[model samples]
Target: MGHGTRDKILIAAATMLGEDPTAKLSVRAVAARAGVSTGSLRHFFPTQRELIDTVVAGMYTVDLPDDPMQDTASPPAERLVACLQLLLAQVGTGESARGYWRALHAAYVASPPSDDAVHAFLAHERLAVHYVERWLVRLRDEGALAPGEPGHHARFLLTVVNGLLTERALPGDLTRLEFEARTLMTAASAVLRPASSDRP
Candidate 1:
């Protein structure tokens, strides 16, 4: 499907932000990147804050595939892993992706609590929580998660994932991708199948 002007603007903005984390994201810069005039951009986003809010909201609303846990065609464990992998892939160590994340984080930190920014940040956070909740619910239905508090477990796992992503971004003794994935899988498996004596 053909993306609209606003969509194109958002995409261009995201691409530029991803390339240069410190980008100013000015009307002129975004317009130039999108190959649209400032007037065209202003038609959709009247202000810089409006554009930033839309981009943040857009980040959360992006679609993912249907839950694999609900799909009987695939093994539950494999499906869970696939879902986790999808989340990881989004914030992986790719230069562009990392740059985008850094830029977003910097903006969040620098900006004061405006209604637009707060709304978008809350929306994005809720989306992340929702994504994890869905996965946990599906796993619970598939008998992977134990009885009691699936939402709590989901939140905990999501927090862990977020922490790992932060660590990956910072300078430190970075964990290898394989090791990080394995660690998450092992922790999840332990939480879901406490009865199993095997440990990673």
Candidate 2:
């Protein structure tokens, strides 16, 4: 019964994240969603950071839908660009992007984050980098990309993504999507260099 209740809480939290990327996974919110008492939630996850980390860690094994990396027919750069687009699509633009940043600030930036909160944030960031590295490794092994440290390459791509996320929240030109696509294409091309097909 203890294990079942814990699972119930995790499922409820995950569902909330899925429904809204900006949903604040507060203890009370999760408990209410799980149809469990706050005490029950606290029993399994003593802190909001623990609950968030557990739900995100659980998601590590779940494959993303329509992963473009699996599409071998496309050039490596195009495939990677598509994958990055999938990430960007989640945050969206304008109000949706603003909402996400606001939630993020309220959770981790409004005040000094607890150590556990910092750890959770770093873990999530590393997981994102790991996913990108995996795709880079596959491309390298298949001779679609130049051989190099995939981790470094992944971090570079993620940095570009970080910049784009900031841009998404601010007022932008009508060609935002086009600008994003071009930027990603450039980044992807740079990372896949020495490959004839990857040339800009």
TM-scores of the candidates in the order shown: 0.60, 0.85
- lDDT tens per residue, model 2, 93-147: 8998888788788868899877766766777787888888888988888876755
Candidate 1: the clashing residue pairs are none
Worst 10 residues of 2 by lDDT: 191-200
- Model 1 agreement with the true structure over 1-200: per-residue lDDT tens digits: 22588888999987764455345568999999998999999999998778876775665655576745556687555666667667666767656445656667776776665665566456556667777777777777767676668677767777777766765666555456677778677657744755452356
Candidate 1 colliding pairs, count:
0
**Model 1 poorest 10 in a row by lDDT:** 190-199
Report the Cα lDDT for residue 56, model 1: 58
Clashes of each: 0, 0
Which candidate comes out best when scored by TM-score? 2
Model 2 has an lDDT value of 0.85
The per-residue C-alpha lDDT of model 2 at residue 24 equals: 61
